[model samples]
Target: MSQRSFRRSIAIWLAALFAAYLALAYFAAPEFWTFRDRGFRTQHFEMVTHTPQGIPGDPINVGLVGTQKEVVHAFAVAGWDTADAVTLKTAIEIGESVLFDHPYPDAPVSRLLFDGRAQDLAFEKPVGAPAPRRDDGRVWETPCGGGGGRPRWGGSASFDRGVGLSHDTGAVTHHIGPDIDAERDFLMRDLATAGVLISTGDISGVGATSTGRNGGGDPYFTDGEAIVGILKQ
Candidate 1:
């Protein structure tokens, strides 16, 4: 350890691998070429897969793409950005809604929440169960994405179903009914104190999304996100 301190420890490990390749080329997965971009144009799967969103819960079908500001700057540097707090609280709730002890208000059946909604979802049957859920029967709705098919409240939805998530109290309960009521008044309150529920109107079954307008607190709804029903411990 003396040839000029082994070239100063290889120039401090090459300046920490060029500052971790410029912070993963401006935030991880920039097509991964290096030295400030090359041919990095990701965001594909144009006609993605996965299905089912409402009525059975357990969501996973999001494949819109093009919201990458380094994926909201790595969740605002890992402070768990709620999509940047829905651009600062315009509105953005996501998950949780109960009625439980069903009797009949609108009656289709409900209890939902399914927290984190179903992070990185892909399950057709593997969140744990005897497995039998499949609306893969039909309703592959599409068109109006401006590119061709589904986006006017369209295509591939569902990230959690037969729901059963519980980070102890980070809740998740579903079996929905009573029309859904803004996802059942967001499980009986603005997601306990707004962890996230920013739709606008049309909670059809009273939960997932409707957007037909009315009592959605009118703030210009866009896309979706749900879950919380209570239990943060």
Candidate 2:
């Protein structure tokens, strides 16, 4: 090759390497510098489980940094009803809701896991919406802790826009709204309104700019900060 061409090639390679380095620096450990000084825990922010067919599930958006009882009490104080366990009877009731145009206040929800196990608690605020329509609910699971101390509950709350087959896995799933932060903020507001939140902070559950798709391929977004709520005893 000519000398000029060789020099130009070298310059292009150097520029590409520098650009790649910058991109890595921007995304790598984003929560570190972004949240280092923040008054919140930064761990436990990752995509843990997939759909029932082994596809990725929803991102963890909110957390309850208290005991199981405190968590349950806070939701109860917020007027959210416990969702019925997914069973034959509950399934039949849901079917009836769809067919008879009824409202099932404590209808069952599709299973989602936290730390490899199904959620320990699930709650929903009845909006008097029809089945397979816009449904709003929250799910919680205590993955660890409880040795004479408060346990942390990892959870996700979202607005279900509709019901359809998974975009990725083809399994039946609820389509979630794009603005998950809205739902997270709604929960925070509900708890604060009910005087259940003693203290609150932030944590890194998912890195910044992660547009996650659940097992059913429903897209969700967040500001990468997990809202940690300490319930009042």
Best by lDDT: 2
What is the Cα-based TM-score of model 2? Answer: 0.73
Listed in order, each prediction's TM-score against the native is: 0.19, 0.73
The list of candidate 2 runs beyond 4 A from truth reads 1-49, 133-148
lDDT by residue (tens digit), candidate 1, 1-233: 68999999999999999777656533453222232322112312222221112112322122221122422232223232221111222211122112232211111212222221212211121122222111110012223342222222212222123334221111232211222223323222422244322222222222344442211112112234422121121
The lDDT of model 1 is 0.26
* lDDT on C-alpha atoms for all candidate structures: 0.26, 0.69
Go through the candidates in order and give the clash count of each. Answer: 55, 3
lDDT of 2 by residue, 1-233 (tens): 99999999999999998777555544433333334423222224344443333345667878777776888888889988788888999888877887888788788778765554667788887566565654355555565563346777778877777667556434455677888788888988899999998788887866665567765667777787778787776
Best by TM-score: 2
